[model samples]
Target: MATRTSALKLLRSSLQNESADFRENQWEAIDLIVNKKKKLLVVERTGWGKSSVYFISTKILRSQGSGPTVIISPLLALMRNQIESAERLGVRAETINTSNMDDWDQIKQAVIDDQVDALLISPERLANEKFVSTFLEQIADRIGLFVVDEAHCISDWGHDFRTDYRRIINILKMMPNGMPILGTTATANDRVVDDIVGQLGEVEVIRGPLTRESISLQNIVMSDQSQRLAWLVENIPNIPGSGIIYTLTKRDARLVSKYLNENGIHVAPYFAGAEDDESTSDEHREKLESMLLGNGIKALVSTSALGMGYDKPDLGFVIHYQAPGSIIAYYQQVGRAGRNIDDAYCVLLSGKEDGDIHDYFRKSAFPSVHEVELILGELENSDGLSVPSLVENINLSKGQIEKVLKYLSVEDPSPIYKERTKYLRTAVDYQLDTEKINWLMQQKTVEWKEVKDYIWYGGCLMNYLQEVLNDEIIEPCGKCTNCLGEAIFPVEVNHRNILNASAFLKYSEFYVQPRKQINKGALKEYSIPSKIPANLQSEGTWVLSKWGDAGWGHLVAEDKHNGVFRNELVKAMENMIIHKIDPSDFPAWVTCVPSKRHPELVPDFAQRLADSLRLPFYPCVKKIKDTNPQKEQQNSYFQCVNLDGAFTIEGEIPDGPVLLLDDAIDSGWTFTIIAALLRLEGSGPVHAVALTSTAVN
Candidate 1:
């Protein structure tokens, strides 16, 4: 048994809680872990001291000559928090993650030399070829207590289900017998709990209320994206302190951050695959994370890339620019606020585009039947292949291919296995798991409705969220904006702020951050050079607004569909050419990239723009063959390949300084191909212009 004095001493040291004893539930969990040596599950609230149960138990068990604890956390942010917590408790901890590869060798040596106590790693590290081959086997028998953090992801029924987490059960199953195991999560409904319980086998379960008394929740429903943008500009300063502003996509993250910065808010945009100024180094991710910890910046305009396991105890607020897809995700994100404060805000600024954004994510969330078959068939025919190779043969995006492989690798008695670098097919025949697929889709539907309920339910927002998580809302919590009938957010729009926001969004300039490298192994068929020449590439492309959005974006969309742009667009482009673009670089002639589908639209626009400038107009590029629409193809590399050999210069090459016109630039490959062709025909210096841009990431 863990002595009361020892546990309290550890708690005081680790959390500075000043408590003389553990909470009843925490003690129960520790007792089962230390004395009983029984596996346990802790489904607790965000601030319920879940880490203390494991940290205290690790100390107790280590004293009894148990091996070092191995924790499979779901995020690098979580691992960082756990390591810090462990340090506070006087336990030596180190982590091996994607972010810190140079230190991995030293960390591994420390573990082998018995100089480390607790070791934290991301769940996806289990599937890492180098780590699995080099570290996992050696550490398998040395794990005294194996902990799975954010265990909710193991359940397909869970709102934030990840395919990688399901593989943790297999790791657990493969571990030495009688190893004490623990799974911890903050959000899980009845179905999710049952699913996790089934996977973990017989274990002690300690569940608690899904409530945070300190957080005041509210849904400030805005009429449009513009209103939401304006609301953020006006209200963010009014909100108490530094926090996170969550967006649905990376593009929005950048735009929101840009707007806030222009308004003197001093925020940063954080997202997955975000890099340093050179767009190669991952240092920016580390820097942003540090900024949040030190409160060096007011907030991070972020996508879900900033979500999951980031610990900021005194975080003052969490504002969702767009509502998340489900109660599970929303609660998890909003919970980041008020961890150590009494009155923090959890506000959701719901826009009309929220549902559309949610649906887009859902559609790409899983691989279809045909995608699975494509992967399995390719593997069956070869000895082995890697993800990059699979991307060349299979038309799926690198992300989609990797996702499919991740799903396949989690299957029990898995039919696909990786040896060293390449993944190989097992002897077993591959077949789609229709049952599992249907179940996953059904769960997504439930989650979609779950978000709607939170937005529309005419009761306490916190209570609604708790009930949605399968916990009883005993009474209305007056802490929420719904029950209190007030919020920190203002009741009406600020017209001046609205005008500024509209102007900011209206002239938002997105450049063609062109592809730095060609998609590997598919170059031979295109007859194009392996390397892109600098002169042929688009010097710059302007995105005046977002697609299907407010202000200029709406105008662009109507223009795209109606095949005619308004005079406002003409003036915006004219202003961009006059002020933003250099006069010496102005095009002597305007040429449009022909689209077989929208053949007349872009060409007509180019003519109008040239007429406005009194420059020559020519359709210098022809769509020689019918090809798949770039939007229909999700893979950027495939979009590049799809565009190759599909365009040819038409009529005579335009004279010096040709401007390339297009409706929108998604992959930027269209402009790349057309510009290359024009430059090859001795056309003058090429510049590209587009109405809008989508995030390449």
Candidate 2:
């Protein structure tokens, strides 16, 4: 036999055992260590097989026979996923966690005695006094390597922060000798990497790019509220795979999940603050796990509660019903898909109002020191406290309470936590008197009628409340189905079929669906309100009004750009009722020229707009449309964009009323702007309408 060098033999065997999931990019990382003798901190984007680095490293370390390896995991669910994968490969790996409460001593003994090759422990357990004391005293010198999973938590700026991370450096200090450190996380940013290195004291940085070439990202700017529901109904069936639909609130998560399930797409919903009806925590977890792993449930809708721990690599899509709090949040939420390096898509269905809604839900500032003191004071005597009890005792709002709890559990240094988990409120086997506890489950429903009413009849308050508060019972509407009549199943109705029927009925509704082929409103009547909807020529089309012409090119609303406008609109519309503006001013205010394509309909359309706006001029439709010529009187019907070309101020000209125009009333942006300006200029309230309402799209 030829004398083979050790490196040559190892290379030959490695090539022969190449894995299907391995990529050249992965090898580049391993090569830095194996060939260059450089300790690496490899960071790969989400779904890029970052786990392979360690799996391969395990063999390299075993061959070296230095010592056993240790992995620190953030969540028990995550630990299980990795442990199961290792077990299947005949790798001896085990995890220690609060889940195995009774066997903590046994697991600790294994780590001290070196009975385990690879051990996984939750961050909380790693910080445990008993665990830390034992590891520092006995096992500190035996460690081969340290793996920090979800290392992004080390950064205070990151969305998911773990307080336990602050002590990770301290733990490492207890180690007998310096060892190469690996920080792994899918959602690491520059800020996170800096924080990790700074906290760990000594570390090498290996950051992977955030871009995933295998994934496609699209932002769908829907025309109206109903279009989101319609898009799901139409496309969900064609693209069949497990997907996660993220919503801003639990109510929206539940409603969206229900709507998808109703439309033949079986969906399961996970919410942050939902009540569990099961008798045990395991039962609740089992039920949720069954729904996630079982067949037929192809989609799961949830809030951020589903973001941190869950892993199912074959996800086909992640749809954000609303924009997340930050771009980082947006990235992390969408990163859930394409984990297998397979083709997948992430679509964000955003609107002009998304940022405003996000602001309404985001924690505005850090929890005050006083607030934290109050919380600790309340819980000082108790071994553990439920969320509701904590909220009540601390006198903090529910939102504030949640933020505080998340901060304490994840972000704050030297945070206090109970060694207990909250299970469902236990029920007695004996029949007991039923009492309705002070539990409110707020929800919002997206039905054709509600969408239509919001666009055509309701004021800003109703629209704001409906969109912001869905699927939960926030406040009881005595008239709604759940309040008075019965709990209706959204499942009986088909969303797509309902939309198709509504589209066909547009003739009666004084609207027309743009032909599928002739987009850009080639027929003039079917044109979209915006410059041209990207999807118009492809699958669907809708009618738009004249104002859409200029309004479409205006700056898109975002939190950083148009927060002032949203705040002004919200403030002005807080107390006002919906009213229409006069028609005499409509002519100059009209942004797009009327179709003139319909000679017989000019006066008819004019009068319709006037009536919708409740304009005093052109009150007599017959007089305005009369063929006999009458000298027209001039009216103050124009509002001009400032000479500098900023948004035109809509107010009463010291001489008279000013006209405002818009393409449609989907979000009532135009109306809100005009209303705000008019209020500022002492012009009373705004009354306005479009050629047709665009809700129920």
Candidate 3:
């Protein structure tokens, strides 16, 4: 019932442009879905109008008495964009995601009553038992079309594979035969395409060239974080329009945003915020996105959390603080720019820490054979265990445990299942796939090498990326720095800017928030209540730097190894405390967190600090019982259990507020336990400070 002419008219209506028409294969894909009810995979570059095909097809299908189209989107940001786009074509669209749980029942009822034309949900929702049974199953038979946005994620070999996406194959297996299914992505290559095809089965593959003529690519190598910050401060203002600055970690994102803001650039740090904080709340992320789209801010210094399917057509540039691990990922991110404008800049500033960060991600990507065996053996012997319970018994972190469980449960014959709150073992015999994992690991190594090659590659930068992605068109664009035989932006950074950046990094302080509650059963010998008493709780602690980070942190790490704090570090700490802390609220005395391995390590530093502050020094907190290092303890329960009854106050308690100093803070349980002891011994308000903290704020 759907024709090319009708599709064109719908597309024009959606675009608000009467002269607009479908690109080369958009109509063919839409017609195949609407007329023949066939499965299709579209491998096109970004801004290629993939969403238009699905929206137009949904409109045609609903008019012909088909059920509402269902989309399994990968991100909340993508869903928000798609819902708005769908409304323009006169399609009634709604999304069910983590942000809008309260509206699920009403949305489900609307779907049942044929009041909604399209439904978009995250792939994680397919794994939720309540959502599947109560909502998905109710309308399963009536679904007209199935769509998977960011389809490359379904491939384990893809650059950004997610465990939740494996559930889509199971959903496909249950769908009625001849139901139209569409998978769309901008970054899939030959291998990823083949894998997605194998999973989806007999799909029409529509592939296109991956070259972007509107973007000019360049790469610069800066080994130091301060140098990169200086480059951003020097060059970001000269870039034509608002853009995004990508950092590899949340800590770096915050650091870069802070440095840029101090230098008069209006930017905000955007990353996945802590679960307990409102920083990355749905409302906050949406607001930031809106600001970037409206050109209210110069850029968003973000982690990979801001990557993929964020629709801002006129985005002027994308600058990476460090190189990404793979060319495919880099292509996908850089593709976000120059969609609706010409001459958008794509720059990659390589750093020394990029390889180390990539190595950390590659190694932690999969559980080892030993870890899988330990988890399965534990699950096999017990009736069932929750994630927290498993954390207490095993040495794995909560995230690693969840990864293992999700990986095992997605197989054809799964070895595990969840009932209510606990995971139960199935009869299926589980064997670790070392060969597949090894191949995947090897593949990552290859990908990382390719990224390195791209950085130093002598050819046209755009051509190199296109060739890596197996794009059919491999000609130079005559726009890249290499192609033009000149640098687009100045590579030399000002020495003064670097000095300012270094100074800022040295003085940036983080707060070590006090733990308000103790894990149950972690302190059986002590009378510590589950809810820590407020009067006995330590005030927020000031952390001088992050362990092994830039500026003072690097000095702290070196001093810890050398077993003596440097005079410069001592002077820096004195300056920080004097300027950061109110004179009236300054600690009356200083005490070190005693260490047995290096008995003189912290106490000597605390004594010198006390001398500088003209306060009495005390080596009062003694490690009465030897305990495992806090870093070895993976979870809160294990961390708390390791420190229980481990420390005791040895000397006279200070009358006024006390400064609890340590070389480094990891779990903060050490400070908590010691602070409670001091408070109980008649010490006034306790203030905790550390030279460096291991945790990111």
Candidate 4:
């Protein structure tokens, strides 16, 4: 066994942690790495010093004249933390990632010369042709240790598994016999543990109790979005320290951050949603992380993007505005709180719309079999179309198209292959198996149920999570809301603030940004036989509410039943038209987007709207085909194609402006195509209106 004295010295000097001793399992894990030279899997809760095991071992091994350690990390944020930690230990460390493109050659040289003791890389880096062919191959003998952080992702059973992580399996097979491998994770159940162990061969398995003594877990069953917002505005200040508030979607994150900021809480939303701008840059994200570490802000409202790699020891509290989809996800996110402090609040506020939001997420995990077949058929028929070209032909979103191509192209037995940016079908006879897909669907359903189980399960919330993660919970935590019999309602209710939140939810003002680019074949398919003119577009298309918002979203979904509304739709439409959208130059005539499935529903609403506004109603556009639902088309460009020939002029229309109405605006493709038709015949301006905007949905 290695001497404990040297390990302790290195650990103290590395972490600057005042704890003179190591945790019970920390020393054993390090010994196996430095002494036994055996693979290991450490499954402990977060903040349990998993990084220290490898860091200490890297120092010991390097002291013994061994080679550098290579860590396969999942995120850039995680890489930054590891690099800084290694440097703190006096270990020469460097990272190769997208941001440091300029220094990659020099970093490569440093690795080749053995000047760097540790190197951090992402899983996606394994698939980069230049990286795999160059530095990775050259440093094969120089890598004494291979570490897979967030290793739960390597197992398909884990909730957050990335398909790219499969590369670790092949890398594992290529490792030399004596080199020690370590797989570490904070959330791994029995199935995930077994799957990870199976991938790494015979290895030491270290498990620990999943409960945290510092976190006081709690949950409140909120009635609606307004109540939750009001509660957050009133309650966040009471929480002990500055921490994170997790949201289910980017829209919610930004909205909540705005509301909190308005109510005097200094919080900024952190998410990776840029319509076309550069992605969340490393410098910006790092600065945010630093601010949070130093308590410069009250909190950061974020999605799961900020979950794994960040380390703020004394985070005050963590509150989830909506319940997570699974227990595993909840545990991993809530683990971020109370890492260093003795007590921190972990709260979850359940919203009625969470189910709707999660449904949107669940359906998109992998493309449907029908959708995949459509993409493959399109690619096979064309001569290796690039992604942008596929965007013109296929009906999938840019994100979905790229993901489908990436998964198929990266994994073995791929039926479709990419060559020089264009894709083509290979001789590999592969199709998505029905049974496997069905099983995956079944698994997802069970996971959703488990999330509900945690809420309604009476005994102990922490122990419930423990059992879910396959940990032994011998006794109740006695710290959660249920165990303590402590129910926290609105400590101080503000009737005015509550009403203000309700007003904000009801204040529905959303935009319909027109699609600037159309598929090459779409205009011809519609028989317009001309490019869409700039004037032939809905300039001020408006919607009353957004999908899953607090205000008209709930009323439209439940009251209108996502169908046609009577007085509510008329009143909301008039309110929007008279106040929100009054084009002085033209208020000509009114029309509605004809629906094949609900033909009478929309025209009835439109005719009523025309009478209310004292304008003539025209059935100007017709559904050309028994057209597919816009939702089914998955991609915006294809959505336009689906509606291309579906609309034609009712007859020779007047030369005045036209007001088009629809139940919901999905892709804005329908608006663009119909506007082209309206302008083609003899209509002035076309302003589209809808009850809600389901674009994000």
Candidate 5:
């Protein structure tokens, strides 16, 4: 019953523009989904109106008495944008995500009563037993259409593959035959496309050229973080309009945002906040997105969490603080710029630390053979184990345990099944796919190499991106640095700006938050309570730098290897503590976290620091037993267990607050145990300080 004219009318209504029409193949996609009830894959570039196809299709299908469409979206931001877009065309759309748990029952009832036209849910919801039973199963038979936004994630070969997306294929297998299904993305390469097609079975493919004529691409190399920060302070103000600045890590996102703000630029740092952290809640991210869209901020310094399905048509620029790990990811991120504008800029700033960060991500992406075997063995022995129980027993972090379980439970003839809150092993013997994992690692290496090549490519940066993505049509854009034979932004940074940036990095300090609770059964001999007693805990710790990072981090690293802290390092620490710490919180005396491996290293530094602070020094804490380095213990339980009975308080107790100093801090368990010991011996409030933090922020 849907025709091209009716689709166009609906599109115009959605866009609020009477003259707007479908781009090439848009109508064909709608026809396949609505008229023929066929599964379709649309691989078009950004701004090609992919959402219009599904919105219009949902309208046609609902009018014909089909069930409401269910779209498995990836992000809350994406869902909000889609719901708004759907509303413009008179399509009633609602979402059920983590942020709105209380509304699930009402939304489900609305779907059952045929009051809702479309439903958007995250991919993780498909794996939730309660959601599947209470909502999805109730309306499975009459469901009109199923949509997968960011479909490339369904394939492990994709640049941003997520384990939760594999659940979509299982849902697809259970769908009734001839039901309309749609998979859409703008960044899938040929290999990722093939993998997705194989997963979806036979489906109509609509592919298009992946070129953005509106964006001018360039690559600039900076040797260090300070230079990059200086460049941003100088150049971002001169850019055409508000946009996004991408960082590879959350720490850099915050660091860049802080530096830019200090220099009078309006910006905010955005990343996937820790679970239950209200500052980075769904509402907060939505607010930031709205601010960017409204041009209230200059740009958002963000991680890849802001990458997919974020809709903003007139964004003017996207500057990368470091090169992304792959060209596919680069294209997807940069594509966010110039969606509806005539001119925008896409710049990549290469750094020395890019390769190291990429390597860390690549190596940790998959569970190792040993790790998988250990988890399966434990599950095989027990009746069942919850995630927390597994974390307490296994040496793996909670994240690693969850990843392994999710991967195993999604297998055909799955080796495990979840009952209530625990995962139980099945009779099926699971075999590790070493070959496939190795191949994937090799693929990642190749992708990273391609990114490096892109930085130095001679022909055209946009052309290189298109070719890497296997775009149907690739040609020189005549708009990149290679095409223009020069850079668009000034390569040289102001000397004063660099000095200011370096000083800012040097003075930045991060607090080492004390652990409030001990893992159950971790210190059975010590009889420590689950909730650490507040009175016995250290006030907190201040880390002067991140290990081997900007500012004093490199000096800390160098000093540690040379077996002595430099005088300049001590002076810097003294200056930082004086300026950064509250006067009332200053310690009355100083002590060192005793180290058996290098006993003199920390003690010598502590003694000098005590002299500089004009406070009495005490060799109060003694290492009673040698233990494994805290870094070797991957999880909290193991880290706590390793330090049990490892230290004891020696010498006379101090009456006033004490400064506990260490060369480097990781896990913060050493300081916690030491502080508790000092507190038990009648020492005053313990203030902890460290030269640097070894853990990645």
Candidate 6:
């Protein structure tokens, strides 16, 4: 323990000496690395200094002890960058890959002799039989720390996946003893984290913030096609520094780069799968490298493959030529600009074309667990398969194939390190439920409710559902394209246009309209007695009663009728009120179904029922010229009903017990509306009850 502590202190000292570190973002991660002994999962966004945490952690581990530290990275370029950094800083770090195979014997000797403190290898290299055996025989028990960079690649759901990463768990077990692992990544959703937990078996998680505060994010909606091009030309030169322009396709990368070049911006373009010259050896590679490192090239517009090792910190901005398939991919591409964080900007030039791109990718992005299982089973039955073979035979998207490999590695660790041809157990046992997978897969494939074909529009689609359908579960997504004024397509084109064409409009309006004489008189024939529901026994309350289709009658009842709509009118009456509201106001709200239902009746039938029951109605008393000593003006009273739409009681009401009525309560909107109107008309705190509420839809 003393020796370990001392070594850690030395490591910390070395790191502090090496870099001019910023205290804020760097410290939180370093503290976690230095103090936390358990396995740590750093879930952060891109360009958030995920790598720096490990660098410091490695320094501490190497300084404190006689143990070896192995950093397993999926990207060779990333490994090379780390190695170069360590060399420049005069720290101990070395990488092993195909290029370094000639020195394999010397490297093996170094590890065996305990001369090297830190070694980096690809997951593919560690999974090699000879390498695993060598590590187990010599360096396994001595390893104090293990680093899995780009750890999300071990999950089937991560943005950038490599099938080989899944085998890492088995490699860990092959070590002499289990030690704490540090897994890191810039892109990991919840699903990816679950996969990582499964692989490490005994694990601890420490996630950083997903929102990058230093990076400015902007989304521009373009209607005209040429606007995007014009913006690109104007913005690129003004920024004046190293930057990346990301595009959806290789063709776009080529076109955009050419356009920029034609407009006097020096630019270079590279596509992921584009062919290279056959004759290009080391010199040819150097020539291509020069263009990237060349002074003339101001900006490089390309696909994701271009910037793996090209970490230029002075990048002014990152502009999206088109929308990437997923948010994770977008985050990853934009993250390239703000390395070391001196403040940078990322802009998305999104439009209708981008939506098409997103839809295409989302639809084609999913892979089947069955296909993944088959590929792995075949490899176990034979030897491990190459990426190309899996891609061809599985018939899955590249992203999907990567994800499957990631899942298998974490879920079934034993298979990762197996070298002999072994009959495989079913990989399906560890896969996600097929039904859920299908649902999520479908979500990614389609554009979510294109507003043009949608039912409601003023706010977001969610608000529309809440108002029109009375969906209690739906919520307002405050940052929707509608709310942000960031849409390429016209919103008016897709609105349901319900106000003009809807049948419920007129009825909803009439329910809320002020009536001068709801009841005829207090005379013998006008007063009515109705039994109220037990749930609403409160006096002075108003409720709407449904007599039949389009026959909603307002009843101001002192007590409840059984236990139903004690407040507002039914959907039928609510529709009438909505029709009265000017079409200009797009009201956004959510509501739950009311507790009551009632049958509708004709006006004559309603009047007859009231007369038979001796219900009292007070007529509007206008101000009289000749004042009778006993007669007083009765114009201060008002009654109201909750309709679906907005309406004001425009006239004076006769004071006294003002009874409000409309329709049965289907949703609470009726009650709220009635209560508000009653209050406005000097009806004092309203106490009302309702009749039956029948389901309309």
> Whose lDDT is higher: candidate 3's or candidate 4's?
3
TM-score, candidate 3, is 0.98
Per-residue lDDT over 236-314 for candidate 2, one digit per residue giving the tens place of the 0 to 100 score = 6766477778877664566567667656788777764444665354345435645665534677777787675466777
Evaluated at residue 559, the lDDT of candidate 5 is: 89
Candidate 1 per-residue lDDT, tens place, 1-697, comes to 5676777787777767685567658988888887877888899888777888899888888888888899888766677778888988888988887888889999998998888889998877888767766787788887889898888988877777888888788778778977889889898888888988888889889998878888987787885766787888778888887899999888889888988898888799988877766544356776788898798999988888777778888898999989888888898899889888888988888888888777777777777888998898899999899888888778787888888888888887688999866888998776778887777776787887888777877788888888888887788878877787766567578888887887877787667665445775444445456677776666767666677677587788877788778777877886777665678877888888787777777787778888888888887688887888788776756777777678888777756788888878787778877777788788887888887765443
Q: Model 2: how large is the Cα RMSD against the reference?
A: 23.1
Query: Candidates' lDDT values, in order?
Result: 0.80, 0.48, 0.89, 0.81, 0.90, 0.51
- What TM-score would each prediction reach against the true structure? 0.94, 0.53, 0.98, 0.87, 0.98, 0.53
lDDT of 4 by residue, 97-179 (tens): 87788998898898888898999887888866567766687777668899999999988778898878887777666667799
Writing each residue's lDDT as its tens digit, candidate 3 over 1-697 gives 8789988999999999999978989999998999999999999999999999999999999999999999989888789889999999999999998889899989988999999999999888888877787777778888999999999999998999998899899877777888999999999989999999999889999998888989999999999888999999999999999999999998888888888998899999888752325543777888888999999999998888888889999999999999999999999899889999977999999999899889988998988998889889999999999898898888777888898988887877888898888998899888988999999999999999999999999988888888888887657889999999999998989999898888888888877689889989898766678789998899968889988887789899988898899878778888878877777877899887988888998889999999988999977888888888888887788888988888888868769989899888887888888888888888988888889988633
Q: Give the worst 10-residue stretch by lDDT in candidate 1.
A: 520-529
Specify the poorest-scoring 10-residue window by lDDT in model 5.
273-282
Candidate number with greatest lDDT? 5
lDDT of 6 by residue, 1-697 (tens): 2233443344445445533443344555555555655577876655555555666566666666637678887654467556765654345776777656788788877876777766888777754666677564467777867888888777756666665776676777766544657888766766678878986876767665554434555556554334565677666776646677887766557656766776688886765444356632333333333554443467777777654444455566788866665555665676676665556666667645665555655555544656556656656565566554444444443455555554454554234433353223344435445785676666444324432223224565334422322223344444434555674223221123222222221122212222222212211221221222222222332223332322243232322344333223344333332443333431121111122223222222233323433444322211212221111211111111112123334456545433334324443333444444445555433333334333221
Residue 480 Cα positional deviation in candidate 3, in Å, after optimal superposition: 0.4
User: For every candidate structure, what is the RMSD over all alpha carbons to the true structure, in angstroms?
Assistant: 2.3, 23.1, 1.5, 3.8, 1.4, 26.7
Q: For residue 322, what is the lDDT in candidate 1? A: 90
Cα lDDT over the full model 2: 0.48
Poorest lDDT segment (10 consecutive residues) of candidate 4:
272-281
lDDT of prediction 4: 0.81
Which stretches of candidate 1 lie above 4 Å from their native place?
16-21, 278-282, 520-527, 632-641, 650-656, 694-697
Q: Which stretches of candidate 4 lie over 4 Å from their true place?
A: 17-19, 100-106, 113-115, 274-287, 371-385, 388-398, 409-417, 424-437, 488-498, 525-541, 547-550, 557-564, 574-626, 645-660, 675-688
**What shift in Å separates residue 224 of candidate 5 from its native position after superposition?**
1.1
**What pairs collide in candidate 5?**
none
- Which regions of candidate 6 fall more than 4 Å away from where they truly are? 1-36, 44-48, 98-106, 126-130, 134-138, 176-178, 189-191, 210-213, 223-227, 273-296, 306-310, 340-343, 351-433, 436-697
